[model samples]
Target: MDLDNLIVMANRIGLFFAAQPDRDEAMAGIAEHVKKFWEPRMRSQILAAIGTEAGAGLSEIVAAALTTHRAMLQPA
Candidate 1:
């Protein structure tokens, strides 16, 4: 998938989890959703984008979730 599309999807997930009362849980929820539903290649591409200018488009919560749960999102 394209990086922009990935960002949109991740941000959408973040939007859903943002309603959670606990910030940590929200981030974790975002990470878990990505980890569970996205394929390894898609996850890898998103991870790479997270370090680049394209990543700036990501929502604050999505960026935080990507940063905080990076290890878990990495492909084996």
Candidate 2:
């Protein structure tokens, strides 16, 4: 998937998790959702995008989740 699509999807997940009462839980939810549902390449592409200007398009929550839970999102 393209970077834009990934950002959109991530933001969508962020939106869902943002409704949670706990900030930490919301962040973890975003990471877990991506890790569980997105393919390895999709995670890799998003990780790469996180290092570039394109990543600026990511929502604040998504960016925070990406930064806070990067290790979990990595391919294994």
Candidate 3:
């Protein structure tokens, strides 16, 4: 999978939820969207990108949401 593309997609998702009045809800929405929609492999790929230079492409919200809800987003 293309990590750059995934980061772009996730950043888009974060942009959408960032408008929410509630910060926590926005974060939850981002996590839930990825968890429910992304395949396990996709999820794993994106998760691995966190905190690395490749992950720097991620927006603040995407990075934070991914980091904050990591446990929940992790594929079994």
Total colliding residue pairs, candidate 2: 0
lDDT of 3 by residue, 1-76 (tens): 8999999999999999999999899999999999999999999999999999988999998899999999998999
The lDDT leader among the candidates is 3
lDDT of 1 at 34: 95
RMSD of each: 0.7, 0.9, 0.5
| Descending-lDDT candidate ranking | 3, 1, 2
TM of each candidate vs. truth: 0.95, 0.94, 0.97
Order of all candidates by TM-score, from best down to worst? 3, 1, 2
Instruction: Tell me the lDDT of candidate 2.
Output: 0.91
lDDT of 1 by residue, 1-76 (tens): 8898999898889989999999999999999999999999999998888868978899988888989999999999
- Give lDDT tens digits, candidate 2, residues 26-49: 999999999999999999999888
